[model samples]
Target: MENVSTRRSGQALLVWGLLVVAANLRASLTGVGPLLDQVQADLGLVPAVAGLLNTLPLLTFAALSPLVPRLAARWGAERLLGGALMVLTLGIALRWVPVAAGLFTGTVLIGAGIAVGNVLLPSLIKRDFPTRVGMLTSAYATVMGGVAAVASGVAVPISEVAPGGWYTALGCWVLFALVAVLLWLPQMRAPRRAVQAVRGHRLPWGSGLAWAVTAFMGLQSLGFYVVVTWLPRFLQDNGTSAATAGWLLFLFQAVAVLTSLAVPGVMRRAGDQRVLAAICSAVMFLGYLGLLVAPGAAPLWSVVLGLGGGACLVLALAFIGLRAQDANVAGALSAMAQSIGYLLAAAGPVVFGLLHTVSAGWRVPIVVMCAAAAGQTIVALAAGGGTVRPATGEVPDRVPAPR
Candidate 1:
């Protein structure tokens, strides 16, 4: 009885720790964009340099994600996560130094830590809660979205009264990171999983389905980041107040959070994700179209995007587990999807802005976003079946047509 009770306690702790992980995933990153002006003023940075501050983390994600699974294979997922949390804590504090070098360096560390967490969590869920992948994936996604939205909403307000303005607001995330580290201590001490199954020596790079999954992951991320980076400015440029535009962006994220909670229930009875994925893609396309066609209804379009984008995020994360045969494959697939996904997403904003600059209007850029969403649907249909595949180095031709 005592053993069973202890195990239950441990499982609960793990879930709590993962929720904390979800919280940490975006809070630190999201808070910065809102505080960018303050950071710019304090650091005496050029516009290009200030923009680099935001782009640095995604670049770190792109560079570091592919290496994390192998590290987790040797170090054990629990210990790796604990170490990542520690790094995140250090990065958060170092970012508070109010120095330009400190800011950039700390941001890199934060990304390195989060890159590990982002790849591991889905695989861990596959290992521990095999029967409940959809539920738990949505749970973490909801937590991530909610915390990110709140972080972005509160950053400016927090900086206004905090001792060091943006520095303090940025550093505030360390408190959560520390708590995650403390809670994760027990997981590291627990017996590690067999190392052979998840050696991650061979990612699913050769599989066609794997590529489809990666494309879905990348395209969804591309749309989301493009919207996140430009939505406020687009609103403001169209004659909205800065404060109102910020609130609209917050509403956009809030809707995503609320919509994420409903995804698991949809996944429960559905045999495959084909319809759901298609719906999400089409909805995002419409949202972008609405933005391009009628900027005055931006508020409504924001909510529509939140609904579609949030669901897309949950599906993208869940696809790692859903498409993989086991925890080992989940680990590898997660690595492949995110390494390429983030790299693609990191380039999205730059390309999105370039479109705007060359055309001298938002039309060309938004049309491109609409095109990306259309592309997302093609990959979604390709990857949406419930078929699970192994980590073999070849593509399967027997995949069922999407219903």
Candidate 2:
């Protein structure tokens, strides 16, 4: 009974600790876009360079993702996560240096830290809570999306009162990393054990299902990053108030939280998730269509976009664990999907802008995205069905398997 009690206590800690870690994943990055104007003025950066603050991280995510499984194999996930939080903290603080070089350096560090969290997290879930993937994925995703929206919403407000202006707003995220580091410290103390799993899993490059998953992940990320990058400016360009634009973005994220929560339950009950995938993609297409065809209904469109984008994000993340037979396979699959996904995502905003410039209006880009979202429906159908091909040398799937 005492051992059982101790086990329950540790499980509870892991649950809430994962939630806390998820909370930090996107808040820091999301807050920066809303405050980009201030940074641009303060640092004398051109618009081209100003955009790097966001894109640089995605680039880093792309570069660093493939190495996380190997790193986790050597250092163990808990210790690696702890080290990442420290890196995140240091990176967030480095932004206080107030130079363009400082911003680039800090952003790169932040991306590197987040990249590890992004890849290893699903592996941790697969290892620790094999029986509860859907539930836990939904919970953490809800937390991540909800906190990210809040960060974006509060960013302008925080800058208004933070005496250091945008610097304080940007630097405020450091507190979250600090807290996560403290919360995760207990887990890292177990290093007397051997290094974690995640070896013997190849990249799954030959698996068509794996490729489908990677494409789904990338397409969804591209849509999301592009929207996050430009939706505010798009709304403002059409004469909406700044506060309203921010709130609309918040509403988009808030709606996503609901879908993110609901999709996991559906995933568990359904034979396959193709229907959910199709419906979500359709909703996002309509949202993008509504924005282009009738900018006046931005709030309604934001809700639609959020409803779809949120679920797609969760599916993309959850599939990493759900599809894999074990933590080792999950880690490798995640590394592949996200490395390519963020590479695709990293190009979205730049391409959106180029289309806008070449066609001399946002309409061309919206049209392109509408087509892309339509393509997503097809990819979703493929990725959402059929058996997940396990990475090479993976053990058969297990239930309630502890790492």
Candidate 3:
């Protein structure tokens, strides 16, 4: 009885540790947007360079994801995750140096750290809580979204009061990463042999289902990151105060948190998630259209976009697990999907910024967003309906292939 109780205690600690780590993944990145203007002024960043703050991370995620599985194979996911937390902590702290070089360098470090966590967490969930992937994915995603919302909401206020201003507000996230590192230490001692054994299967790059999943991941990320990068500026342009705009961003993320917690379980029981995907696409489209047509209804549009974006995220991650035959395949698929997906997503903010710069209006950029929504709806439908064939490594024709 004592042994069982002790094991349960350990398990509980692991879950908590994972949740804490998840919370840190996005807070550091999301916090930047709320204080972007301050950072730009302080660092003397050009608009093009300012856009790099968000784009660089997505580029890093694309570049690093395929390589992480190999690192996990050699070092074990737990040890790698702990190391990532350390890097994240260091990155967050480095931002306090108050120089343009320090800011960009820290952003790179933060992105690298997050890239590892982003790819590994789904695999970790598959390995540690195989039976509870949906529930745990939802839980961690919720925590991640919630903390991100809080980080966005509080960034300006924290900047206003912190001794080092925006830098201090950005650097403060190191505390969360530090705690995650400490809690994750115990996991580093876990046996690495299992991770090594599963490292042999090549990712099915040729599979159509794989590309569908990749496209779904990419389109959703493109939309989400564009919003994350620009929504505050959009609101501010329309005469909203910085604090109020920050809170609206928070509301957008908070609504996402709720939907992330609910969407996976709801979809898991359905025969196919294409309908859910359609609904999500519609919500996002309407939100964008609302923004274009009725700038005054920002609050309603924010919630609509948040719900859509969050549901799309849950579905994307869930598909990584649900479509795979085993954890190894899941990991491989995750790497491929994320690598391709994020690279594609990296263009979103840059392109959106360029469109606005060229046209001198939000209308053109928003029309692009609406087109992305339509494409996401179509891809999600295909991805949601496709199935993986373990024997030949092909996607069977349950869903029509994207032409």
Candidate 4:
């Protein structure tokens, strides 16, 4: 009985730790948009250079994601995660150095740290909570979205009172990362077994279903980042104040938090997720169309788009676990999907900004977003049809061997 109770207590701690990590992952990035204008003015950056601030992280995500699995294989996931948290802390702190070099350098470190967490967390969920993936995924996703919303909403206010202004607001995320690191420290002491490599078994890089899942992940991420990067500016352009635009962006993320919390369980039970995918796509399409046609109804469109974006994100993450055969494969597939997906997504904000610069309007960029939504719908249908392959074996639940 004591052993069982202790195990349960440990599990609970792990769950909370995971949630805290998830919360920090996006807060650092999403907080930037709300303070973007101020940062631009402070740094004397044009729109394209400002857009690169958002794009650079995605590029880092693309570049670093593939390497994380190997790092996990070597260092153990728990230790790697703890190390990543430390890096994230350093990165966020670097932004406060009050130089353009400091800002971009810190952003690069932040992206690299987040890239490891992004690829590893789902795999960790699969490995540690095999029977409760949907519930736990939903929980962490909810926390991630909710924290991101709060970060976006309060960024301007925080900057106003913070001594270093936008730099302080951006750098404050290190506190959250530091807390996560402390919470996660207990995990490093727990035993973990190394995942054995399967002989003659290569990852399904060419599988059609794998490609579908990758595409779905990419398109959904592309749409979400584009909004996170530009939604505040969009609202501000349509007669909303900067503070109001920040709250509206918060509304967008808050709605997503609700949807993300609810969607995973529904997806788990449904015979096929295609219907859900179709519904998500429709909501996104209408939301974008509404944004283009009726800037006056910004609040309504933000909710609609948030619902769609949130649902799509949950579905994409769930697919990463549900489609894999085991935690090891899940990690590999996650690396592949995110590597490709984020590379595809990295172009979104930069391209959106460049188009806005050349065309002198938001319409063309939005239309491109709508087209990405269409692509997402098509891929989600394919990905939702069924699982691609069963995991060969479960990764043993023990502390990974020392490097």
- Which of the numbered candidates is closest to the native, going by highest lDDT? 1
List, residue by residue over 1-403, the lDDT tens digit for candidate 4. Answer: 9999999999999999999999888889888876778989989999778877888889999998878777887778888888998999999999988889999999999998899899888888877787677778788888988888888778888999989999999998888889999999999877765542211123457668878989989988888888887888899899999778877878888899999878866876787678898789778988998998898999899999999999988878877777766677677778878999999888887788789989999999999888888878877778876554533443433323110
* Model 4: colliding residue pairs: 191-398, 191-399, 192-398, 192-399, 192-400, 193-398, 325-390, 325-391, 326-391
Model 1 lDDT at residue 247: 96
Order of quality (TM-score)? 1, 2, 3, 4
lDDT of each: 0.86, 0.85, 0.82, 0.82
Q: Which lDDT tens digits does candidate 1 get at residues 332-391?
A: 888889989999999999999998989998999999889999999888887887444665
Better of 1 and 4 by TM-score: 1
Clash count in backbone of candidate 1: 0
Mind sharing the TM-score for model 4?
Answer: 0.91
Cα shift from native, residue 380, model 1 (Å): 1.0
> Residue 143 CA error for candidate 4 (Å)?
0.6
Clashing pairs in 1: none
Model 3 worst lDDT window (10 residues): 394-403
Alpha-carbon shift of residue 56 in model 2 (angstroms): 0.5
The best candidate in terms of TM-score: 1
Instruction: Give the TM-scores of the predictions, in the order they appear.
Output: 0.95, 0.95, 0.92, 0.91
Cα lDDT over the full model 3:
0.82
2 or 3: which has the higher TM-score?
Answer: 2
Residue-wise lDDT of candidate 3 within 336-367, one digit each (tens)? Answer: 88899899888888899899999999999999
